[model samples]
Structure formats: structure tokens, C-alpha cells
Target: MDFERSLDLLWRDKGETPQPTRGRKPKLTLDKVIATAVALADAEGQATGSMSQIAKELGVGTMTLYTYVPGKAELLDLMVDSVLAERDLPGPGDPLPDGWREQVRLYADRTLTVFRRHPWIQGMSMVRPVLGPGLMAGQEYLIATVSDIGLAPRKAAAAANGIEVYVQANAALTAETAQVEQQTGQSTDAWWGQRSVFWEKYFDVDRHPAMTRMWESGGYDVDTCEAVDEAFVFGLERMLDGIEALVS
Candidate 1:
């Protein structure tokens, strides 16, 4: 996607792009176009989605959409930001949690909530970031939260990013697990247990000492499907612990 093109579309409401009127009746709005595209993506997978498909769903010619959104890439940027705006991150003057750890947790939890609601987001690469108002608000929240603590400016920003990376990675894993279940028509637990024969027949304790030790110690007792969430929390707290040590 063109960098300037995305930024223009993303900040269009802020006057970055022209909002000229096409018809006296105004048949469609940018929000309507983006909303319809989001619904289509939510129903079908994002990879399978296209501008023609969205246009078809909206009952308009595909070319008509270009007037409002530049293309699929820009539309995707809007769609992601639209969903992200659903989060309830408070404004600067609003009452917020007192503890820094709680503030960080709030950001992580809200982001994961968005990911679960829109599993298709797991397919989008946020490395470039949407850079829309929705993402900017989140970035502000994290930066402000960590900056209030005693860490240096860069380290605080780094801490926020570190937490974000862990959250996104786990969110993607959760989405992948759900996608596998949907595609195979088999529950994750059932599919995992189906591979028990591999552990029993091909298992070699000598070759995999760590696994053998963990298994013998009942570390593998939990249902992995159910444990994915627990694993996320465990890892998140460990990361938080390191950050807290920095603060101290």
C-alpha cells in the first residue's frame, strides 16, 4: 500500500483528503462503504475478500466505491481502525486506574477483545500500522501510561511496544486455533488427542529430555485448547514482572 495514500484516506475526516459531493441526494457515505466492507470481511475470510465482492454486497458498481475509498488497501486501513475505535480507552481528563500495571493491562485486554471480535484482523500486518485515529488513541494510551512511570522516555515506549508484541502474537495464535477448528470441522481438543499415537509410538525420552521430564511431571496434563488463554496470562505477567522491576 502507498504510505501517503493510506495516511490521506485514514485522516480524510481531518481534511487530509477532499470530501467533494458527487450527488445531491448523497447515495453513499464513506462510513457506509467501510461498514459494508467490514461486514463482508467478517463473514468471509479477509484473504478471500475483494473490492468487487464488497461492491456487490453494497449493491453498487465497484468503480463507485473508489470515489469514497482509494482501494482495498485503504479500505482495510479504515475497517481496522473502525473496529479498533470500538475500544473504550478514556480521554486524558477522564478517570483512569491509579496503578501503572493496571493501565498497561487495560490496554492489552481491550486490544485482545478487539482481535476476538474481528478474528480476520489476525491476517492483517500491523507492522505498518493503520495510523488512523483509532490506532493513535491506543498509542497515546500506552505511551502516556508508561511515561508516567519512572523509566526513561525510550524505555517507556519500548515497554509499551514489548507488551503490544506479546498481545498481538497471542491474539494471532488464538485466531489460528479457531480457524483450524472451523476448517477441519474437528474441535481442537479432539484433533490434538487424535495425535496421541505419535507420542506413544514414536516417543523417545532420551532424545527429548525436556519434554519427557515435563510430561512425567504432569506438565502436559492440561487440555491445550483450554490452556492457551492461561498460557497468555502467564506469559503476560512474566513480561509485566520484568517491566515492574525496571520501574523499581
Candidate 2:
């Protein structure tokens, strides 16, 4: 992953770039390269967001691009961090939203916005964090919000992590649903409707008591992939309620 190079570039300031050893007078910055990579990934898919493709998009040679950044691995770290900055939430010095729950909602809302904007990000693995400023900043903001609710520091971090876990999974679900529609050329409703026979002809109430009960009890009112957003909202609120309970 070009670990050292990626780590160094991750912490580099926006204006700071790699010093190009004597050559044709450096023509690009690491930020610009990463920005182009992000744009490419946003417009096309991540597969097309490679180093060669980035240089093609930027109208520069791949070697020239390499001079600004080490390799695709390093550039990806920068791109993920860059896209994450889109949240644009209030950070350390700025005032957080009214209540702790409200602040958490704000975090959820901003995160969903970015995920929807860059659905490609949903497919990527963040198994290891980039630990860049953009990521650390959001982490700091959420930790502060959770701490404000009077939880211990470690617990506050856990709450923030747990909240983000749900948020990210919800985002992946929604994004993948969209991806499926695009790939299969069938909208979720149409795809889901094609399987209605399973419920009508194959589903047996006696075989699945909980499913039958929930369906009869109107618990499936917001069911199905069509109302995924509403379901996510309900789940998020319930999660917040649980967190609120801890302090109460």
C-alpha cells in the first residue's frame, strides 16, 4: 500500500506537495492529482479510477503523475480523505448543533450526503483507516458530540464508533441497492415485485410465525427496498434513543 508514502501524504497540508527533483519544472501538485482521481472515481467507477486513468483524465503522463504521488495506493488514501471532507460539519472550535442527539443527526445526515454523492466509495474497503486530517477531523467532531452527552471518554468513542458503524452499513445498503439496479437494468421495485410469488404462493404463515405475525401486524408497512430510506431513518432514531437511555 506504499504505507510510508501514503501516511506522509495523508498528513501533508493542501498546499504542500512532493518536491519534484530536477525535471521539466513540476507541472502538478499531489492535491491536484488526488482531486482528479476523485473526479474520475465520481464520474466513472473505481475500476477506471486507476493511476493510468487519472493521468489520462489530467492530461499528464503517468510518470509525471507518479512524481507528485508515489503510486495508486498513496493516491487512494488522499482521495478517500478528500471526498470525506465534503461533510463540512462544524469542527473543534465551532459550536455543535443544539442537542447531542441533534448533533449526531447532523453527523448522520452529512455522511449520507457524501455516500450518495460518491456511491463508488461504498464498494471500497476502509478496513484500515487512512488516518488523514479529513478523517481525524470528523472523528474528533463526533467524539466531542458524544462526550457532550456526559459519557466517559472511552464510552463516548464507542458510541461514536457504533453510530458510524450503523451509518456506514446503511449507506452501503442504499448504495448497493442502487448499484444493483444500474447493473441489472431493473429498478428495485420491479426486481422485488418479480419475487412476489414467493410471498403469495410459497410463503407459509405456519412455517414462519414471526414473519407472518409481523406482516399481519402492519410491521412491514415500511418494508422492502423501496422504502429503504424510511427504514434507515427509523433505525437511526431507535439507535439514538438507545444512546440517550444510557445517560438517562
Candidate 3:
């Protein structure tokens, strides 16, 4: 399917929600609590947000939050799911036509967009299995799309892993960039440019031919948005190529 057509379908899927009420009331719901926590995290860093903080924002006592979420861990999980629930998958029968590559790229892009907005997601590193319905739904979409390419279940699973890893890696890098800029008061490009001059003067170019060549060629000047798009496509394509070898 054309990209635009696929996106239209995805948007329709993302529209599955009722508008939140504006005024405060006597009762609290898990949805409202999660939304408050998410907004708090968006405005302030996630580390600074707590049940007490969110409760104050919502004009409730700290203990009241527990009525919605059992504890902070559950609150965090709810926050993550609240964000993930906003993601859209390609609609039924609207799967990418170029095999798994396009599907993976689209998935990675959508995921990166979410992580970029919520950079604190980088702090969530666990080997435990994903149980959140939102996350499970995303994985299911990826597996089903990959299965459409005539890939075996195992290979498709691996391919999905590769796509998710790529997205997470990029999100981590983006978050680090933001962190570095905040600390040094310099953009990534500015910081790198200032450091590169020192390196060129101190190090022998001949010692690292590949590094020297890339630096001299100004290859690091690649546009950030374009680089992200290219990386997702390149990595997904190479992964799919490997899977095709295995499946065929």
C-alpha cells in the first residue's frame, strides 16, 4: 500500500479514545491518574515526578493515588501504557507491499516518535517480558506484518527484535544528546565541532585511515532527521535480507 494510505488507516486506529473531561470531580479514575502523571513527566523530568507530586497536581492527597494505582511501579507501568496506547498500527489489509522492510521502518519511526517525546523511557531497562497490552499489541502488529512476508515464526520474531532494538538504540542516543546539551549548553553539532579541532591537532590522522577519511569528508554533518530515517531503513533492510536468506 502507498505510505499515505497506510498512514490514514493508522490514524483511524489511533482515534480510539474518548475526550477527557476538563473539570475536576469527586471521583478519580486510573485513566485520569495516568494522564496526570504523564503530563507531569512531560513538563518536569520523570525522576522528579511521584505520586505525591501528581496528587498535588490533581488536587488530591497522596494516598488517593493508590486508589487508582496500587503503587509507584504500577503507576509507572500505567504511564508507559498510557503513552504506548496512543501509537497506531497499520490497518488490516494495509500492510506494506515492499515486504518487511517498510513495515519495520514504519514501526521504528512511530516508536521513535513516542520515545523522543518521553525521553525518560531510556531509564526503563529490564530483561523481563513485556506484559502491557499496548506493548503486546505493537508486537503483535509487527509479527503479523512480518508473517505476511512468508517468513517463519521464529525468523519473524527475530526480525521484530531487530527493529525494536534499532528504535531503542536511536531513542537512547537522542536522549543522551539532549542530556549532553543540557549539561554543556551546546548542541551536538557545536560540541562535536569544538572537540574535533582538538582531536585533529593531537592525533595522527594516518593511525586511523577510516576515521580520518570520514572526518575529512565531513560525513558527520549528515542531517539529524535524515540520518534517523536512513538508519531505520538501512538497518531494517539488511535485517530483512538476512531473514530472507534464512527463510528461503
Candidate 4:
């Protein structure tokens, strides 16, 4: 598909049209279907889980699941929303005690934690905005926190979206890393180590100066959350600095 069509599937803002329920009446409620799907994802990874697998786990036929969720896509949306519900939020007017940067740090950490626990959630979430309450509340909290830094509602919403994108992108990369490890029975380090010789043989130092510098800087260390956090801090400061300059 084209970029816009792919983005449409990712953001899914066209409105919440429930898939027409079909097939034999399921003994399962929507909640059961969602919950089972979530459980299956938790255990097997999102890509590994399928409608048939989920139905078998719930002791229902695949057709029975179709009655509740329009298809695997809808089921994924429900699973994401359900996972979001597990996240805790700061209370109203609790005062994001440490200021905007700290508030954002905590927010990103919490989001990352959730994605780590539910790795499949990263895959499911990027598919659409289901207007699910949990996702809405999380966004609302981010906007409110940004407003404390004196951003107007529109600006705050935009900033919150940017932060959300960062968190999701990081989690997606990490999840892919895990999947690679699972499939190859090798750590990312080992895989890269095996490829380093090939890269060294073909990659010219003069032709890709910047990439050579980055590669020489010891690339892709998994035990570098601190480095990642520092980059996140740097990016956030840049964002806020740009906003401050604009507002000033």
C-alpha cells in the first residue's frame, strides 16, 4: 500500500464503526474475546497469536470470535485498549512535582514499562486510535502535564503526540530486537558481531563519514538505557527549547 493508506491503518481516525457482528452467537462477550486475545498476545507475542489460536484458548471456534470482533484488526484494537487500562495515572491536579521534563521522563518510563510487559501491545497500538478510554486518559494526562509548562491546549496536544510517538517507536524497535533474538537463538550482540566482519570488508571509511563515525563509536549496545534516556532528555530539551523560542 501507499504511504497514506499505510498511515490510515496506523492512525485509524475514520470513526469507530463496529464490525458487523456475524456467525453463530458466541457464548463469549466482547470482554472475554478481548481478554483472551490479550492473554494470547502476552504469552505468544502479537504476531504469533491468531484468531484461531485465541478461540481455541477460550474454548470457542474461530467463527465465534468473529461475532464479537470484526476481525483480527479489531481484536488487536481491543487488546491494546485493554492493556492501556492496566496503566495507572497521576491524580487530578497532583502537580507534576518535578516540572515538565521530569513529568515527561516519568511518562515515558511508565509507557515503556507497559510495552515491555505486553510486547505485543506495541504492534497492536500502532494500528489505530480506537478512542478507547485508557488511551484517551493517558493522552489527556500528557496534555495536562504539558499545559503546566504553559503550552496552550493545541500546543500541548501536539507535544503529547510527539512524546507518544517517541515512546512507541522505541518500544517497537526493542520488541523487534527481542523477536530477532528469539528467532535466531542469538543475542543482538552476537548477530551484529557475526556481521561486523562483512561490514568492515565492504564499507568504505571515506564514502560514509558520519556512518563510519557512528559505527566506530560502538553501535547498538543493549545495556544502554542510560544512554537512551540521555538522548530522550536531549530531544525533550530541544523540543521545549524550540517551543520556548517560538512563544518568546
Q: lDDT scores for all predictions?
A: 0.80, 0.78, 0.66, 0.68
Q: Return the number of clashes found in candidate 4.
A: 0
TM-score of 3: 0.77
Give the candidate number with the greatest lDDT: 1
* Per-residue alpha-carbon lDDT of candidate 4 for residues 1-248, written as tens digits (9 for 90 to 100): 13332233334445763442577645766777777777777676655688899889999777887676556765665577667767666757665647766777777777767776777665554655665666876888787777756677788778788887877787666666565565567876677677878776987889988978876787644344456656656776787678667556
Instruction: Report the C-alpha lDDT of model 2 over 1-248, residue by residue, as the tens digit.
Output: 67877777887666665475345777877678877888777666443566777888888877788677777777777888887888988976897678888888898888888877776777777667778887887788888888878788888889999988898899877767665666567887787788999899989889899988988998887646647888888999998898889888
Q: For candidate 1, lDDT tens digit of each residue in 116-194? A: 7777888888897888888888888888888877899889889988887898899888776666666567888898689
lDDT of 3 by residue, 1-248 (tens): 13332223223335654222243343776577778888887666443587788999999888776554556765676677657656776656765547566676677777777776776665665245234666776888777777766766787778777766767687667665564565467776686676776785877877888988997798756865567657766776787678778767
In TM-score terms, candidate 2 sits at: 0.88
Model 2 misplaced regions, further than 4 Å: 14-16, 21-23, 222-226
Question: Which rank order by lDDT, best down to worst?
Answer: 1, 2, 4, 3
**Model 2 poorest ten-residue lDDT run:** 14-23
**Backbone clashes in model 4, listed as residue pairs:** none
Error of 4 at 222 (Å): 7.8
What does the lDDT read for residue 144 in candidate 4? 74
> Clashing residue pairs, candidate 3?
none
Judged by TM-score relative to the true structure, which candidate is superior, 3 or 4? 3
